[model samples]
Target chain A: MMRALSWQSLVAVLLLLAALFQLPLANVPIAMTAPAVAWTTLILVYGFLLAGIGADTFMRSRLWRGIVLFLCAHLATVFLFTLISDENGLARPGFYVVLAACWLLAWRCVEILSGLQPRSRAGRIILALIIPAIFGAWILIIWEAVTRGLGIPFILLPPPSAVFTKLIFSLSVIAADVNQTIFKAVLAGYLMGCASGFVAAILADRFPFMRRGLLPIGNLVSALPMIGIAPIMVMWFGFDWQSKAAVVVIMTFFPMLVNTVAGLAVTSTMERDLMRTYAAGYWQTLFKLRLPAAGPFVFNALKINSTLALIGAIVAEFFGTPVVGMGFRISTEVGRMNVDMVWAEIAVAAIIGSLFYGGVALVERAVTFWHPSFRNGKA
Target chain B: MSEARGNRIIPVLVMLIAIVAIWYAGTYFMNAPFQRDLDRRAGVTRSSGDLFIATMTQPKPTLPAPHQVATNFFENTFLRKITSNRSLIYHAGVTLSSTLLGFVIGTVLGILIAVGIVHFTSLDRSLMPWIIASQTIPILALAPMIIVVLAAVNLTGLLPKALISTYLSFFPVAVGMVKGLRSPEIINLDLMHTYHASKAQTFWKLRLPASVPFLFASMKVAIAASLVGAIVGELPTGAVAGIGSKLLAGSYYSQTIDMFAALVAGSLVAVLLVTAVDVVGAIVQRRMGARPS
Candidate 1:
C-alpha cells in the first residue's frame, strides 16, 4: 500500500531530486572562479541529499530518519565552512533552492521522529534530545549560510563559525570573566539577597504591621531600575565585585521577599484550622505545612533571581568594574571592534545563565514534587 | 465590605508614616559625614541641633532628604523651560518617545511571530527555543554592540534606541500571545469547525478576542521593559538628552542629590506608563463587551 504523503514531504522530496542535477548551485560573487573546495563541498552536499532521499523513500522508522538527519546536518556544516573559505559573496538562486529543500526535508524528518511514541523511558529521552538537537542544528546551519552567503561584515554580524573559534581560542579569558562575574558577584549576591529576603519574609509573616509596611515599599523599590542604583552602589562599595554584588542584592531582594511573602500566605484557613486542632504551634506548623506549601513560590523567586542576579552583576559592571568581567569585556571590546570576543562572552553568558536556571528548576522539581503543576509525568 | 476596606487603609497609612519617619532618620545619619567634614574643615563649632538641620538642608547631600528631592523635582520641572536640556521634563520626553516607538514595534513583531508559531507547528518547536535563548543573553550586554553596529550603518538616534527597546519588549508579547491564542476551549474550537469556519475566520472570531486580556497583560510588562531598553540605549550612545543621560551626568559630577532626584523621576515615569496601559486596557476591554474583572 502506498502511504499517503503530506504536501511538505512531497515538495521536499521533489526539491531534493531537483538539486541532484543543478549546476553551480551557488555562485561566489567575490571569487573570480569557483574554487575546488566549493565544488567539492557542493558535490558532497548533493551526495548527502541523494542519500537523504534514499533513506526517506526506503526507511519509515524513526531511528533511520534521525541518523540520516544528523548526517545531513553535518554535511550542511561542512558545506558552510567550505563556502566561507571560498569567500562566497552571495548565494545564487540555485543555492537558495537547494538550501530550502534540505531545510524542508530535515524539518520533515524531525516532524516524523518527534511524532514517534517510544515505548521505554530511555527511548523517549533519546527521541526528545534528538528532536531539539536537529532543530537547534538547523538554526546554526541557516545562520551560517545566510551570513557567509551575504558577505556580511564580521563587525556587523560574525558567523557562528567565527564565534565558535573565538570561544575555543579564548577559553582562559572567558573562564576568568565568568569566575569574576558569576562566581564572585552573582553567587555572593544571590545567596545573601535570597537568605535575607527569606528571613525577612518569615519575620513579616509573624508581624502583620511589618508585612503591610514592607510589601508596598518593596513593590516600589523593585521598580527602580538597576542603572539608577548601580552607580550609587559603586559610590558606596567601590568599583569591585562588591558593588556589583550590592546591585544584584538590590535587584534580587524584593522579588524574593514579595514572592516568599505571597507564598507564606497561601496556606488556606482550613489548613490552619486543621493545624490548630492538631495542637501544632506556629513553628511546628510552619515547618510541617506552611513552608512546604510555600515551596513553589519560593522556587519561583529563586529561578527569577538566578537570571536577575546575573543581569544585575553584568549591568553594574558596565558602570564600574576591574576590567575582568563579562560586562566589562563586552563594553571595552565592542569599542575596539572586536565583535567576536563580545559574541564569545555572550555565548558564555547564555550557557551559564541556562545552566543556573536549569539547576534551580531541577531543585524546584525535587522540592515541589507535590505541586499541582508537577502532577504530570514530567519532572 | 466598607469596614474591611477602612481597616486595610489604616495599616497602609500607618506604614507610610513610619517609613517616612525612618527615611528622615536615615537621611540624617547618612548625610552627617559630609556635614561633619565640612564643619571640621571650616573650623565651625555647630550645636547638635544645627548639625541635624545642616544634614537635612545640605545642597549636595550624600543622602538627600525626601523633601529636598521633592523641591528639586518641583523646581526642575516647573521653573525650567520644557524644551531646556536642564529640565527633567525634556529628558523624560526623549526617553518616552523612544519607549513608545519601541513598544509599538516590539508588540507588532511579537504578535506577528506568535501568529506564525501558532499556525506552523514546526516553527513552534524550532523558533521558540531561539526566542527564549535570545532573551537569556543579557540585553545590556548586547546594547553597546547594537549601538556601534547601527552607527556603522549611519543609523542613529531614535531608531536604534527603539530597536533596543523592541529587543527587550518583544518576548513577553510573543510568549503571552502564544498562550493566549491557544487558550480557547476545545469545545469552542469544535463548535467553530461545526459552523464550517475557515482558519482565518476562526482566528478572527474566536482566538483574537480570547487573547485580548493576555495581550494587555503582556503589554504592561513590555512597556516597562521598553523603558529600560530606552535608558540603556542612551547610555551607549553618550546621548546628550534623556533620563539615562541625566543619571550619567549626575553620577559623573558626584551630585548624589541630583542623581536621586533623577532616579525618583525615572521611577515615577515607569509607574505612569504602566498606569496608562492599564487605563487603555480597561477602555478597550469595556468596548469589547467583556465585563470588568
Candidate 2:
C-alpha cells in the first residue's frame, strides 16, 4: 500500500491542520446567519482531502486523481466566494489555507493532465481545450473573489462580476465601437497597409535602388512611436475612422515590408541556381519556389500586423473620434468616472484582439504547413 | 567590398532624392487648398512657382516641408537650453528615464517568471497561456484607468508610466527566456542528470548560459516596446513634460512641425536604445566565449 506520503498528501494534511483554527474568513465579521455556504464549502474540501489521502491504488490513476483534485478546486473556489463578501476582507490565515489548497490542487491537476495520454484525436483535442479553459476560468474566479472580497473601489478595479455585468448591459455601445474600430479602421488599414507593403517588397526585390534607399527609411518610420502619429493623422484626415485607419496603415506598413523583404531574402543561392537551371522565369520562380519558402515569414508579419492594426485603431481613437469607438469611449468614460464602461471597452478590445490574432494564426498554420516549426504537430 | 559599397551609395542617394522630391510635391498638394484659399481672400493668384514656395514656407501648413521639420528639430534640440521645457532633449530625457526604469524592472520580472515557468511544469501549462493572453489585451486601452487608479493612490509621474512599460516589456522577455531555458538539448540534460548535479547547479551552469542570447534579443524588443509604453503613458496623464506631452501639446495647438520634430526624436531614441542593447549583447557573448558571428 502507498504511504500517502506524496507532496499532494502533505499539502492536504497541512490544510487539514490549518482548518482546525477558528479564525474568521475575512477581515470584517460576516453575517453569522449566512454561514451555510461557507460551512458546506469547507466540509466538501475537507472531505475531498480525506478521500484523497485514503484512496486506494486504482483511485491514484491520472484520471481519478485529476477529477478529485478538480473537485477540491471547485469546492475551494466556492469557499472563496463565500469568504470574500462586500462586508468581509480576507482573514490572513484563512486566505493562506485557501491559497495553499488551491495551489496544491492546481499542481496536482497539472501533473495528471501532463501524464494522461489519450489515443484518440478527438480526445486529445478535447483535452487540449479543457486544460487552458480550466486554467483561465480559475484565474477569473480568483480575480473576482479577491476584488469583491477586499471591497476594492470601483474606480481602482471594478470586480470582474461588475465588469461582466457592465459588458452584458452595454452590448450596443460595445458593438458600435467594434464596428467603428475593427470593421472600418482595422480592416481597411490592415488590408491597405499589408497589401502595399507586400507590393513594395516585391518591387524592392526587383530593384536594388529601391531596396537600398527605402528599407532604412522604412526601419526608421516603423520605429516611430505609432501613438505619436495619431494626433497628426487626426489633423490630416479629420475626426473619423479615416484618421484611425491612417494611423493603422502607418503602424502596420513597415513591419509587413520589412518582414516580406526578409522573407524574400531567405531563398538560398543554391535554390535560386536550381530554378535558373530549370530556366524558370523570374515570376515563375518567385511564385513557385521563393514565395512558398517565404510563407512562414510572411505569416509572421500578418500575425504581428493583426495585433498592431487593433492597437493603432484603438489608440488613434483616443486623439479624436465622432461619438463612438473603443478608444473614444475609454477616454471619455474615464473623464466621467464611468470606470466600469472603460473596463467593458477594454474587455471588448481584449476579446476582439484575441480573436483577430487567433484567426491569423489559424491561417498561418494552414498556409505554412510545410515549415519545420509546424511539422512537429506541437501547434 | 569598397566597390559594392560605392554601388549601393549611388542607388541609395538616387532613392533619397526621389523621396525628397515626392515629399516636396506632397507638401505642395496638401497645402494647396489652404494656399488657394488665402490667395482667393487676398484677391491675387500667384504663379505655380510662387505658390509652391508659399506652400513650403507656410507658418502652419497642412503638411510641413522636410526643411521646415528640420528647422523645427534644430531649433528645439540645439537652439534651446537643455533644461528648457521646449527642448526636445528635455522631453526625451523624461520619457527615457521612465522607459529605462520600466525596462530594468520588466527584465528582472520576466527573467524571474521565466525561471519559475521553466522549473514548475504547472506554471508552464497554466501561466504561459495567460501571459500570452495578457499581452493580446492591448494594455494601452487601459492606460487611462491605470493612470487614474495610481493617481487615486497618490502614485504619479514616472511610476505609473513605468508600470505600463513593465506590463508591456515583461512578456517578450519571459517568452524569449522560456524558449532559451528549454533550448538546451536533451543530451545536455541527461549529462546533468548523470553528474548528479542539483537543480540550482544545472540551472546556473547550463540553462542560464543557454538563455543569454535569447535574453538579449528579448531585451532589445522589450526596450523598444517599453519606450512605446512610456510614450503612451504620457499621453493620458496630460503631463507638462515628456515626448508624449510634446505631441499632445503640439496637437492641441496644431503645431505639426513641432509634432514631427518630437516624432523624429522618439524614433532616434528607439534606434539608439536598440543599438545599445545589441552592443552590450555582443560584448556579453564575446566574454562568454561565443564567437562573433
Candidate 3:
C-alpha cells in the first residue's frame, strides 16, 4: 500500500485523516477526547510513510526502522497523555502537544530525506532545497493549525494566516513604511556611512598618522550603544528621517572603515613588491590591486551594514519620528494592542532586510568570485 | 609589535589633546554667541550693533568647564548618597546589573543553541536559517511585543528586560559559536577519530578549543549589544532607574547636560565591557599559543 502512493500522497492522506478526525473530535467531551489515540494513529502512519521512503534507499536495516517507530511511539504517547489530562475547554494543551510532535516528525523526515545519498547532482540540489522548504512549510502549517485551531489570542500570538492577511490588507501602509524607513533613512545613511568609511579607509591606508589617531576612536564610537546615540542624533537632527539616517551612519561607519582598512592591509609583502615592480603609482596600485583584493572584506562589511542600517533606522525611529515609518508603526501599533499590524510591519521589515543583505551577498559573490574564500566555497 | 604599540599611544595622546583643544576653543568662541542670544531673548536693552559687539566680547559662558563636569562626575558617582536620585553610581548599578544578568542569560542560551546546531546537522540546516531570519525582525519591533506578552503572563520585571537583552545578545553568540564549533579542521577531526574519541570528547578538546577566539570575539559584540538591549528595554517600561530611564527623563526635561552625561556613562560602560573582552581574548590567545596579531 505504501509502494502504491508517493510520499507526498502519503502526507496528503495523513493531513486528510487529521482534518477528518478533527471534526467529530471537536464535539467530543474534553475528558473523552482520545487525543492520544488519534495522535498515536497519526504518528504510526507518518512513521510508516517515512520508513517506506527510507526502505527504497539506504535505510535497509530493521534497526533503523525500529528507531523511527520508537521515536514516533514515544511522541504519540506524550500527546495522548497530555490530551487526556487536559482540563481546559480550550484544548490548547492537547493541540500544542500534537503540533510539536508533528513539527519534530517533519524535522526528522527532512533530515532523513536529505541524508539519503542520491544518484545524481540534480538529486542533491533537490534534496538540499526540499529539506529546508519542507521544514519551513511544516513549521508554518503547524503554527497556523495550532494558533487557529486551538484559538490562541491574536494579541499574544497571531496565526501565520492572520499575519499574512494583515500583510495583504496593509500592503500600502507597509510599502510606505518600507519606503520611509528603508529607502529614505536606511539607504541614505548606508551610502553616506559607507562612502565616508571607504574614503577614511583610503586616507588611513595612505597615512600612518590618521590610522593611528582614528582607529581606536572609531572603535570607541562603534561601541557606543545605539540607544544612547540615537536620542542624541534625534536632538541634533530633529525627530525625522535625518536623525535616523544620522544614527545609521554612526552605526555603520566604523565597521566599514575598520574592515576596509584591515582588508587593504591584508595584501602580502610579495604582492606589494609585485605591484611596485609594475611601477604602479599609489593610486594605481590601490585601485588595481589592493581594492580588488579587498573586495571580499569590503563586501562583508556591506552585507553586515545592510542589517545594521535597518536596525539603526528602526531603533532610531523608536526615539522619535514623523508618524509614518516601519519602526514608528511597529512601536505605535504594539502600544495600541494591534499586534497583528506589528507582526505585519515586522514581516515587511524582515523581507526587506533579508533581501537587502542577500543582494549585497550576491553582488559580493559576483564581484569577488575569484577570491579564495568564494573559489574554495568556504564562506 | 613595538611600532604598533608606540603608534597606539601617540593616537591616544593626540585624541586627548584634540578633545581638550576643541573644548577650549568651543568654550571661548561659542559662549558669547549663546549668551547674546539668551540676552536678546530675555529682552535685555542693547542695540543690534552693541549686541554684535557684546557677542564678540562677552566672557566665555560656563560650558561644563571640564572641571565642573569632573566635579559633577565625582559628586554623582561617589560622595552623593548611593540611593540618591542624582547619583550616577545608583543608576550605573541598576544598568550594570541588568546588562550583566542579560549577558549571562543570553550567552548561555546562545551557546546551547549553537551546540545543538553543531552536533545535529539537521538543526544546522533547518534552524540556522530560522535563526538568521530571526534577526531580520528588528529588536525594536520585538521589544514591545516581548514586554507586552511577558507582562500578560505575569512575568514583568527584570526578567522581561533581560529577555530583550537576551534576544539581542543571543544572535551574535549563536553565530559566533557556530563558526567556532565548526573551526575544528578536518585533520583534527580525523585525529580524534583515529584516537577513537567520542563525539563529546572530540568536541571538548578539538572544537571547543578552536572556537575560543571566535567565542570571545563574539562575546565582545554580544556584551555591547546586550547593553543596548537593556537600555532599550528600559525605554518602554518607563523604569525610573538605569541609564536608559535617565536618558529618557533628561530628554523629556531638556536637560542636555544630564542627557549627555548619561550617554557618557553608557558609552564608558560599553567601552569597559569591550576592553575586558579584549583582555580576555589576549589571555586566551596567549594560553592557546595563538599569539596576538
Candidate 4:
C-alpha cells in the first residue's frame, strides 16, 4: 500500500483538495454559460476518473490507464475551453482543479509508459511514440488553458489555437517566407558552404603541418559568434536573399571545416598501415576508409549547419530584405502588434528546422549505419 | 621539443600571412571597381599602384583592408574612453554583462535540472526528449518578440536579454551534466553500495567530482552561446548600447569600419570567455588531483 503512494497520487490528492475548496469555476458556474452536452461530457469523464481512483490502482494494465488519462485530458480540455469562452468571466480556483487533474493524470500515464517493456516490436514503437505525444499535448493544453482562462494579453502569448488559426490562414505568406529563406538562401548557402568545407578538409589532409596549424584556428572560428558577420555579409552582397545566403555560407563554413578535419584525422596509424598492406594509394585509402569513417562527423556538421543556416538566413533578414522573410515578418509583425502572425512565423520556422534536421538525421542513419550508435538499432 | 613546436608554429604563421595577403589582394580587387567609379566621376586616371593605394584608403571601401579594420579595432578598443558609446570596450562590456549573468543563471538551472534527471528515471525518460527538441526550435526567432513584449510590460534592459541568453545557454550544460553525472563506472557504484553509502553521499563523493570536467567543457560552449544570445537579444530591441546595437547603428549609418571593429571585438570576447572557462576548468581539475590537461 505504501508502495502505491507515487508522486502522481500525491498530486491527484492535492488536486482533489483544490476541487473540494473550489470557488466558482469561472465568474459563473461553468454550467450556466457552457452548453449542456459539453458540461455533461466533462462531468462524465471526471466521474469516470473519480470512480477509477476509487478502484484498486486504476487497473494493472497499461491500456486502461492510458484510456482514463486520454478521456480525462480531453474532457478537462473541453471544460477549460468552455470556461474560457465566457470572455468576461475570470477563472477562479475551480478552473485550476481541472488543469491540475489533467496534468497529473497525464504524468501518471507517461510514468506507466516509461516503465512499459512491451515484448513485441510494434508495441514498443507505439509505446515509444505515445509517451512523448502525451507529454507534448499536455504542454499545449496547459498553454491554451492558462492563456485563455487567465486571459493573458494576446500580445504576450496568443494561445496555440490562435497561432494555428493564423498559420492556416497565412499559408501563402508563410510559403513565400519559406521560399525566400529556406529554399533560396539556406539551401544555396548550405550546399556551397558544406561542399567548400569538405573540399578544404580533404586538401588540408595532404599537408600534415598545415593541418595541425589550421585545426586550432578552425576550432576557435567554430566557437565564435559567427552570426555577428551578418551585417558585413549584407554589405558585401546586397539587401536581398543573396546577402542572407552569403551569411549562411560563412556561418556554415567553419564548423564543417573543423568537424570534417577532425573526422579525417580519425584515421589512425594502425588503419593507415592496414591500408598500406593492401597496396592502396592515398586516394584509395581516403575514399575507402577515411571518408567512410568521416561520414558521421560530416553528418554532425551537416546537422549543426542545418540549424545554423536557418538561423543565419532569418536573422540576416533583420539587417535588410526584400520585404519577405521569416525574420522580416517576425520583426515587422511585432511592431504592428500582430503577435499571432509573429507566432505563426515562429511555428513555421520550428517546423522547417525540424524537417531539415530530421532529413539530415535520416541520411546520417542510412550512411553511418555501421557506427556504434546505430549498430544495435539504438534510438 | 622546441623543434616540434617550431614545426607547428611556422605553418600557422605562414597561414596567417597568407590570409592577410589574400585579404589585401581581395580588398584591392573588390574595391578597385569603386575606386574606378570615383576616378571616372572626378575625370582623372590613376596608375595601378596609385589606384591600389586609393582603394585601400577608401573610407567606406566595399571590403575594408585588413589594416583599416585593425586600426579601427585598435582605436575603438584602446584609444577611447571605456565608458563612451563610441568605444568597442563599452559595447563589449554591455554585451558581456548579460552574457555572464545569463551564463551563470543558465548554468545553475541546467546543473539542477541535470541532477534531477540523473536521480529520477521518470524525468530522464520524459524530459530528455524535450530538452533536445527545445534546441531544434530556433529560439532566436522569439528574441524579437520577447524583447518587444517585455518592453511593453516595462521589463526592459538586462533581464530580458539575460533571459534569452539563459534559454540559449541552458541546454548544453544540462545535456552535458546529465551525461557527466551518470558517468561513474558500475564498479564505482558497486563500491558505494558495498559501503552502504546513501544517495546523497554517493552523489557528493563520487558523482559531483566526476562531473567537473564535463561541467567546464559545457560551460565553455554555454558561455559562447550566452554571448550570442546576449548579442542577438540587443538586435531587435533597437538598443542604445551593446555590441549588437553598435552593429545595428553601424549598419544603419553605413559605418563599415565600426561594424568590422565590433565584429572583431565580439569574436575576441567569445575567445576570451572560452579561454577563461578552459583556465578555470584546468584549475578545478588540478585541485581535484587530476593530471594537468
Candidate 5:
C-alpha cells in the first residue's frame, strides 16, 4: 500500500519518523532554538498531506477532491514556508521534514489536477494551464527554500527571491535588452525569414522538380549547426541588430521552408482533380484548397520559428553586439559575477519566449479553427 | 522506378549548380564595395569584370566565394595532420565526443523517465506537465550560465558542456517516448488482458516493439539537437579546441574563408551524424519485421 504512494510521500514519512526519534532540526545551540516551531510545523504539514492522500483515495466527486487536495497542499506550503524561514541557513532533520511533507502534498495536488476530466472546454483549458503553473511554482519554491536553507553561494545560483528582486530593480536594463533582441532583431528576422520561406515555398511548388529537390536539402540544412554562422553574419552586417537579425533569418528559414513545402504538398490528386472539375485556376486552387489545408503545418513552423528566432538572436549577440542585448548582458554580467542580473535577463527571456510562442499558438488556433484537432478540441 | 530516381537526382544536381551560382554572384556583389575601394587606393583602373574577379580572390573579403571556403575546408581537413589542433577534423572530433556522450546520457535519462511516467499514474500527472512547461523557457539562453557555474565548482571540460546537450536532447526523447509507450491500441491491450499477460510481458512484447519507430524518429531529432548543444557549449568557455572556437577565432581574426569553412565542417558533421542515425534506424526497422515503405 505504501508502495502506491508517490516518492515524496514515502520520503516525507521517513523524515517524519526521524523527527520523532528526536533529531535536532539544525546545528544551532539548543538553548537558542525554539525547536517546537520546526516540530509543530512538520506535524501540521504531515497532517494536511495525509488528509490530502486520504481524500484522493476515498473521495468520489472529482472537483471537491481536487479542492481539498489543493487546500491541503497550499496550507502545508504556508506552514512549510514559515518553518523554513525560521530555520533558514540551517540544515536539519526537522527542516527537511517540513519541506518533504509540503512536497508530498504538492505531489498529491498535482495528481488530482491531472486526473480531472473536465467536461467544458473552458474547464479543460483552465486545468491544463493551472497544472503547469503549479508545477513551475513548486520548482521555484523548492529552489528558493533549498538555496536559502543551505546558504548556497549566490554566484552558483541566486535564490529566486534575489532573482525576482533583481528582476524588478533591473527592469529598464532588461527592457533595453528585450527591445534590442526581440523587437529589433528577433521580430525583424522572424518576419523576413518566414515570409521569404513562404515565398520560396510558392516558387518551389511552381516547379514540382524544385519542390522534390529542395525538400531533402531543406531538411538537411534545418538540421545543421546553422547557429555557427552568427560570426560570419556579424562580420558581414556589422556589430548591430542587423547581424543578429541575419543570424535569426538563417536559423529560421529552413524550418519554415521545409514545413511550408511539406504543407503545400499535402493536397491529394483527388483534391486537385476536384479543383480542376470546378474549373478553378492553379492560383485559385492553391489559395482556396491547398493553403487552407496546410494551415496546421504552416503554424507548426511558425511556432517552431518563434523559439528559434529568439534563440538565434540571443546567441548571435554573444559573438559581437552593440553593448546592449540579451546575449551581451548575459556574457558580460557572468564575467562580473553579477549572477542575479543574469538570472533576471534569463527570466525576461523565458517570459518573452513563452509569450511569443503563446501568441503564435493563439493565432494558430483562431486561424486553423477548422482543423481536425480544433474540431475535436484537443491539442 | 529508375526513371523516377533519375528525375529526383537530376533536379537535385541542377539545384546544386544554381545554389553555387547564386552564392558566387552574392559574394561578388557583397564584396564589390570593398574591392572597388582597394582598387581606388592602389590607383588602378579596373573594369567591372576585373572587380568581380578581384572580389572573388580577396584574402579577407566581406564574403568569401564558395571556392575559397572549399579550398580552406580541404586545407584545414586534409592537409593538416588529424591530431593537430589546426585540423577541422580534430575540432569536429572534439565537438562530436561531447555530442555523442550527451546523446547517450539524455536517451537513458529520457527512457527511464518515460518508463516511470508510463507505469505510474502519479508520475505522469506530476512530471508530464512540468516537462511541457520547461520547453517554454529558452533553455539555450541559460547555457552560458550553466557553463560558468559549473566552472566555478571546478567541474570543467566535457562534463559541463555535455550536460547542456543532455538537457536539450532529453525533452524530445521523453515526450516522444511517453507517446510511444502509450501508443498501444485499446483492442490490443484488451487482448493482452484476456490472455492474462503480466504488466511486464505487455510492456516488453507490446509497448517496446511499438516504441521503436518513435524512438528512432526522436533520436534523429535528439542527436541533431545534441550537436547544436555541443557546438554552442564551446562558445562561452573560451576553449581553444572544437568547431565553436574555430568559429570564434575566425571572427576574431576576420578570416571569412576560414569561418565559412568551419560552418561547412559543422554542417558536414551534422549531416554525417544524421545519416548514421537514419541508416541504423532503417536496419533496426527491417530487423523488427517492418517494411521499408
Candidate 6:
C-alpha cells in the first residue's frame, strides 16, 4: 500500500518537490532564448490527464490505475525537460518553471483527493480535514509564488511569507490591539449587549404592552446603520473602549432581542398546557419549559453577535480611538503602507472570531445536548 | 381580531406620540443652555435672559431641529440641487452609481460561486467555510488593503471603489443563495428526479423559483451593504464626491449640521434603496404566490 503511488499522492509529492526547487534554483544564471516551458507545471497537468485517462480505462481498480498513470505522467514530463533543455544551463525558466509545476501538481492533487470516496468514518474525517487544508495552503502558495515570483511590491499585497514574518515580528503590537478590541471592547460590549437584549426580551414577553410597543422600536434600531450610530456613540461615550463598546451594544442588542423573543415563543401550546397542568406559574413555566426551548434561538443570537460585535468594535474604532485597537491598527497601517501588518491584524481577527463562534457552538452543544438537533447530530 | 388590530395601532401611535413629546420637551428645556454654550464659544455677548430669548427665536440649534432637517432636505434636494454645489442629487448620483455597479458585480459573482458550490459537494464544504471565515475579517480592515493593492497594480479608478462594494456585498448573497439553493423540499427534488429532468432543468424549474424569496431578501441586505461599502471606499481614498466624502468633509470642518444633513441624505438613500427592493420583493412574492400576510 505504501509503495503504491496514487495519482494524488504522486502529484502532492511532486508539487512539494517543485515548491522546494522554486526558491534558489531559478536565480542561477542560465542562457536560453525562450523561458523553458514550465516543466514542472506541464508534468503535473500530464499527471492530471493521465489520472483522468486511467479512470476511464480501468473500471474496477481505477484508483490504483490512476495512481500508476500519475507517476508515469510526471516521470515522462521530467524526462522531456531533460531532453528539450540544455544541461549547460543555457535557459533559466527556473523559478517560473518550478512554480508552474507546483501549481499544476497541487491542483491535480486537490482534484484527485477530492474525487476519492471515503469508505470509513476516519477516512471521511481525514478527507474532510485534508481537502480544505490543501486548498487553503495552495491559495497561500499561489499568493507567495505570485508575489515573490513576479516581484510584486510588498506595499501592495505582501507575500504570505512576509505576512507570516510580520505576524511574528509584531506579535506584541498585534496582541495589544487584539486585547483592546476583542477583550476590552468586544467582549465587554457583547456581554452587556446580549444580556440587556435577553433581559429586554424577557421583559417584553412578560408585558404584553412592551411587546407591542418595543418590537417595532427594536426593528427600527436594528435598521439604523452602524455608520450613523458609531460616531454618535463616540460623541456620547468619549474616544475610548467605552464608545466602541456602546456601538457593539447597539449593533448586537437587536439580534439577541429578536432571536430570544422568537426562541421564548418556541415552546408549543401543548408544552405550555402540560406546564399549566403541573400548576406552574409564568416564571416556573419559563424556567422549566420555555428557556430550554429557547436554547437554540439564544445560541443562534450568541453566534451572530460574536461576528457582529467584532464588526461594531472595528468600525467604531474607525470613527475615533485611543490608538491601540485592531481597527486602529488596520486603518493606520494601511495608510502607512504596511500591508503585511494589516494582514497580521486580519489573521488575528479571523482566529479570534472563529474561536469565539466555536466556543458559543460548543456551549450550545453541551447545554442543549438533549435537543433533538444535537442528539441526532443534524446541525 | 378587530380588538387585536386596535390594540396594535394604539401602541404604535402612543410610541410615536411619546417620542415627539420628548423631542418637544427636550427642545424647549435643553435649547437655552445649548445656545448659551454655543454663543459663549462664538464670543457673542448675551445675558441669561437674552440667551433664553435667542434660544427660542433662533432659526435652529446646531443639531438642527427635525423640522429644520426636513426643510434643509427639501431645499438641498428639490430647491437648490436643481442648480449648485451641496446638491443632494449630485452627491447621490455619485454614490448611487458606485452602489449600483457594485451591486451588479457582487450579485453576479455571488450567484456564479454559489452555483459552483451547489454542484460540487467538495467545493461546498471547502468553499463555504472560507466564505464564512472571509466575513470574519472585517471589510473595514480589508478595504484599505484592497485600495492600496489595486493602486500599486495601477488599477485605481471608480472601479476600485465599486470592487470594494462588490467584495462587501457578495458574501451575503453567496451565503443566502447557498441556503436558497439547498432549500428545495426533498419531495419536490424526488419529483424532479422522477420526471428524468437534467441537472439544469431541475435547477431552472425548481431551485431557481424556490430561491427567489431568499435572493430578494438578501438583495435588500446586499444593496444596503454595498452603499455602505461605496461610502467607506470614498473615506480612505480621499474621493472628492460621494456621501462618505461629504460626511468626512463635514467632520473635518466641524460643520455638525452639514455632517448631520449628509448623514440624513445617506440614510435616506439607503432607506429608499431598501424600500425599492422591498417593493420589488413584494411583487416577486405575489408573482410566486407567496404573498406576505
**Rank by TM-score (best first):** 4, 2, 5, 1, 3, 6
Candidate 2's TM-score: 0.94
In the range B1-293, model 1's lDDT, one tens digit per residue, is 99888776777788888878998999999889888999999999899999999999988776789898888888888899999888989998999999999999999999999999899765776678777767766767788888898999999889899999999899999999998999999999999999999999999999999999999999998998898888878877885789888877877887777777788778888889988998999999999998877
What tens-digit string does per-residue lDDT give for candidate 1 at A1-379? 2355555557866775676566566665563674686678877776776666566656677677767865774576467456545664566556666788678777777767756778898987686666677787777888888877777888888888889999999999999999999999999999999999999999999998788778877766665565568777877788889999998888889999999999999999999999999999999999999999999999999987887888788878878789799999999999899999998998899888878987998999888988878766555
Q: If candidate 1 were superposed on the true structure by all CA atoms, what would the RMSD be? A: 2.8
| Model 5: lDDT of residue B175 | 88
Candidate 5, A1-379: lDDT as tens digits = 1226555556656766766664555555444666777678667876887787676566778688778878887787777666546444766656666566667767767776788789998998898777767777788888987887787888999889889999998889889889999999999999999999989998999989888788888988988988899988898888899999999988888988899888988989999999999999989999999999888999999988998898899889888999999999999998899999999999889888888988999999999998887787655
Stretches off by above 4 angstroms in model 3 are A1-101, A116-129, A377-379, B1-5, B19-36, B43-72, B280-293
Name the top TM-score candidate.
4
Candidate 4: deviation at residue A255, Å? 0.9
Instruction: List TM-score per model, in order.
Output: 0.93, 0.94, 0.83, 0.96, 0.94, 0.82
DockQ-based class of model 4: medium
Report the C-alpha lDDT of model 6 over A48-88, residue by residue, as the tens digit.
Answer: 54454444344345345435544553454444334223332
- What is chain B's TM-score across the candidates, in the order shown? 0.96, 0.97, 0.84, 0.98, 0.97, 0.85
Relative to the unseen true structure, what is the Cα RMSD of model 2?
Answer: 2.5
> What lDDT tens digits, residue by residue, belong to model 2 across residues B1-293?
99989876787788888988998999999999999999999998999999989999988878899999999999999999999989999999999999999999999999999999999876776788778778778888888889999999999989999999999899999999999999999999999999999999999999999999999999998998899999999999986799989988888889899898999899889999999999999999999999877
Instruction: List where candidate 1 sits over 4 angstroms from the true fold.
Output: A1-39, A86-93, A224-226, A377-379
Candidate 6 residue pairs in backbone clash: A7-A67, A31-A90, A32-A90, A40-A101, A41-A101
Winner on DockQ between 2 and 4 is 4
What does fnat come to for each candidate?
0.39, 0.68, 0.55, 0.64, 0.69, 0.36
- Per-residue lDDT of model 4, residues A122-212, tens digit only: 9887876677777778788878877877878888889899899999999999999889888999999999999998888888898887787
Give the per-residue Cα lDDT of candidate 5 at A305. Answer: 91
- Residue-level lDDT of model 3, residues B169-225, one tens digit each, is 899999999999998889989999999999999988899989999999999999998
lDDT of 2 by residue, A59-163 (tens): 646677777767766666665566555463454566657555665666667667756788998977776766777778877776776666666777887877888
Whose DockQ is greatest here? Answer: 4
Q: Kindly give the stretch of ten consecutive residues in candidate 6 chain A with the minimal lDDT sum.
A: A83-92
Please give the range of 10 consecutive residues that has the lowest summed lDDT in model 5 chain B.
Answer: B129-138
